[model samples]
Target: MCLLFRLYFLARRMHLSWVKSALVLWRNIMIKVGIAGITGYTGEELIRCLYQHPKVKISSLYARIEKPIHFSSIAPRFNKKIDLMCEPLNAEHMGDNCDIVFLALPHTVSMEFVPFLLKKGKRVIDLSADYRIPKDSYELWYKHEHTDSENLTQAVYGLPEINREKIKGAKLLSNPGCYPTSIILGLAPISKLISQCLIEPIIDSKSGTSGAGKKAEASFLFTEVDENLRCYKANEHQHIPEIEHFLSYEAGANIKVHFSPHLLPVRRGIMSTIYLNHESFSSIENIQKMYNDFYKNEPFVRVRPLGKFPEILDVAETNYCDIGIKFARGMLIIVSVIDNLLKGASGQAVQNMNIMCGFDEKEGLF
Candidate 1:
């Protein structure tokens, strides 16, 4: 009886040791994520998406605050879901705590903190225009001097459909803008066709008021935007150069877009209607097939059926870019739609992080 009792206790101790080891392994596998600029729409969306991610633990939240405060206090929607604190923007503290840091800041502001975070060996995904184009283009269009030329040269453009392989190994990622996301994806598959036919694509993009960010501008006021449609930048928007740069890269020749952006009264999506001269192209059936073939392997891009076009409601509140094509009256019209806050900004950032970290591309998004 004494021998049997001692053996039972030994087996119980071994089982407890194995259980502890498994728990430690599970904790180690989770990615520790941090967010800077947690007050903006993109930042808030990031918190919402990352909180639902299975492999992520949001370790830190930073903003330009005087003292640390609960994130839920600022964004009440996350009250029960995310109980983290929004601390002041401390690069060192974020670097120490997080394996990856997302900068949802504006253009000039992201450059200030990126180099320091890189030096601390933390991967960065910037959802700003800072690192998207060359230094000269940025300076010319944005009217701001490019400060971090070294990192800018190395930052990979984070469009998973086009730059997936590069994104997998990128240490610094430049997330594409909302308008560019819809426009570029609409035209990427037909890049060679545009080059071969010498076609100059004309893009008319409409976006919701939220694309302007959380600001107190008179133009973006509720009274101004309610039931009103206005075209702000015509052909000379800052995003023009960015769109041209990537499309040019894909086409292997210089590609220029006659882009005009308008403000819609609604709150969250982007629809870019792209018109191309289809004089030298194939039939409508063949064009649709081509787009289908090109994006069949892409996870988030959904190519709609022939004679059907995508609407803003089709992709609202999701990390999806729905595209439809039509050949009519010697013009090939393509429509693309995406939720501005999701696929355009924060959701795309998380997708890039998944690729970089070797997690499933659709892990957090769905």
Candidate 2:
């Protein structure tokens, strides 16, 4: 009887230990994601966010151009924490390295590596202009011949609010531009965008110096932009068509916006003020209620109080887009702010990754 009882007790303890180990293994399997172009500011931010995510892990970091150097040599933030070599972007290694990949390189740059990733059967969230728009638009505006034109239509535009359902299942998603991300989120809650609507939206966006990239240029020099704001890519900016395309498609009508971009002196952030034409101003109470209803569950969007506008400082370090709406002379004026490097680029990509990988959308973003 002593031997029988001892054996039964030992078996029960072994079964419980096995169950615990199984749960731990399941949890880890949900986590390991990777990043491409990890040398860039946005890529580093993705790494930073994943480092904190309970359900995600940065198992790999890739950079084709920034290779043959230590991560810290390229970007000091990853100094010792990321003591890994920057490897080239390829599908051949991703299955061994990571399950999800974020391409934070330039538009044209991402196009070259995607076919390999697809062949490797890896999911992608591209933070580049290459896959953001339609193929013809990419060809016309970017002036680059697309190597993956056939796959362009299949790449889901990864704006969560408008295309949440599709994004949840997409194997490849193209994250929106910083300007378009801010502008669309600011305008969408209140936009009817009907063809007969006489509203002409003027999206005046000003971004910090970081939007230009890490490369040094005389134009982006401190002496040049210290206290000045210069508008570039005015009415004909590339983002204009993207904004119009999303707005029009969402509202089921053609829409045109006078998009104007400006460069600011700060290091990071975007402040976009949208001016709308409406015969009668929507009451502040109604506007707030509407926006609140629309984005109530969206963890990253904040609708500011009616009397107060959002400042860049409030959203500078977050993956949030702060939107404040005001009305005057029958026009709705909106101010939307975002940390261009975070919400505009990497955070959004991670959010899309969470969706694609069947993790909670806010797993790493919030």
Candidate 3:
């Protein structure tokens, strides 16, 4: 009889411990997010960020070819922490299964799924060029037909400092390109100068190799990229049209500028040197006041004080975009840099999602 009482006491103690553990687990649970392209590097980064977040949980991980394996295979460091398998990407089920869906597909692919997700009332953040360009410009550069014309026109350019308010209300968030986001924020204040039709800002932008993604190509391999610093799209990059369109829209004029992109040997980040007519320098105080006031309330944008410029390392793993402007040779030379993968792509998409879903803008972003 004494032995039986001891056994009962042991069982009760074990039960109570499990109950307490379950309560703790429930209390600190995270907000589940669905990643639609789990095979890519950006997708892997999101997995990494969320795995560490106190309030974020990855719900659905999707990969077209790698649909039946653990996420660790693609990103080994993730190892056991993310032992989940990826499923196929289907718009029909995405909205029902996950709280939010992130599309890291190619440019035109998002158009096919984004509308359906929105219709099903799922908030979407696209990390592709599909939603970045206007319908006509997208067709011009991407060389494909965009069926969701309305969404493209209304899509908010997801530069947190500039469009956070619109992002909060948007059902579909159109995250900007790596180079464009970096370049635009740096040159925005001078946009008024250009708007007066009195200034022309020329952007000479360069990026590190990681912007090419994990895909294979003779051009991106070590042999080709090492000791190589060459310009690819001289004046005809897809992002050019996007920059022009947004600038024109913001400045209320037909904005045109010389856009050039170059490839650097390093792995990530971009620096754009822009030249604006010296007549548009405005006062340094006015310039500082404008950029500071513009991004004053914004969390991710930092406008360096006069004579202080932003460096790539300053924002390497962060969601922030830093800007520094100076006048030169009757030209306003502006330089901007970003991680190309973070602030330029996956990170911004998450930022837009936070706004659209009414979650804390900083949740899981830092």
Candidate 4:
């Protein structure tokens, strides 16, 4: 009958419209993110950056407390913008709610939660020394037993400039330390030259007190650090193995570096001066050109011109690493600078997340 035909047509049209609506809904699905150790400095920075991400929604935030407290209460600037509370550590709840998780916990603590998150099929970017190196090296350097050694090989070092392809497919990302980031970015491009030219390079780096963390410590007090600059962990810094491991891979040989880290009186930023000695002098022009070519297409690395040098102000508060190169008196000195909290930790973590999630690498960073 005519009535039956009309009903059939109406149903077909409705089905087609339903299909279209479903497609649109799928396309606009936002990625839900969770942050563990939400009270830490890196976690705060992650919250700040990810809040602006177009395709992201911060679904959960976990701190080390029992009762819930509004995140805005701790960080009052985000009062109106972010309305979530910092919940207690519950890996199962985070894994159920979030598509990806950023672990800003202390070194050994991250390894404990990572296995649970991964078992629940969640991606993780750990901003700790836990998974940066192999288990043996981690135990040797950090003096802690790695509970999840099986996940070590699965973790990709989350330096976007050097490991973009690997980071894209990674489930676990080990965010580099502030010192390692500044030191590695400065040395990675010329790793081959460093291997062939120098016996040992002396890396002198200075970082602001914020690198010490937000924890209340007498050593990091205003009075203690006000007008003082001293070197700690001169040759025994934990980041030594991380820097050397990556550099050795790039150089295709064993390489050693003498590293010294100093604490500056300021708030945030790292300036690393790498002293290189070559058997024969390579022209400053060629050296600068080599660096320029190496990082020309990279979005985050900025190489200065031949006679100019980089300062902390050049890359402070941004996800950028600025390098200044020079050759003088049988030595090649490279100055690299970055904001310790941004390029060194949280911003880089977001960069890795963007890559892993198939978003633009610079998303939410600007």
| Top lDDT hit | 1
Which regions in candidate 4 have their CA more than 4 angstroms from the true location? 1-28
Q: Tens digit of lDDT per residue, candidate 1, span 253-352?
A: 8887899999999999999999998677658887888899989999999999987899999998999999999888888999999999999999999999
Worst lDDT run of 10 residues, candidate 1, spans 1-10
Report the C-alpha lDDT of model 4 over 4-39, residue by residue, as the tens digit: 322333433455676444344432557889899988
**How does model 3 score by TM-score?**
0.87
Best-to-worst order by lDDT is 1, 4, 2, 3
Estimate, for each residue in 224-298, the C-alpha lDDT of model 3 and write its tens digit.
989989898898998888888777767778788788899999887887877776654656677777887877787
lDDT of 2 at 205: 96
For candidate 4, report its TM-score.
0.91
Q: Residue-wise lDDT of candidate 2 within 37-150, one digit each (tens)?
A: 776778778788877777765667778663456667777766777677677776567535666677888768887878788776667788888887787877888788988987
- Per-candidate TM-score against the hidden true structure: 0.91, 0.87, 0.87, 0.91
Worst 10 residues of 3 by lDDT: 1-10
Quick one: how many clashes does candidate 4 have?
Answer: 0
What is the model-wide C-alpha lDDT for candidate 4? 0.85
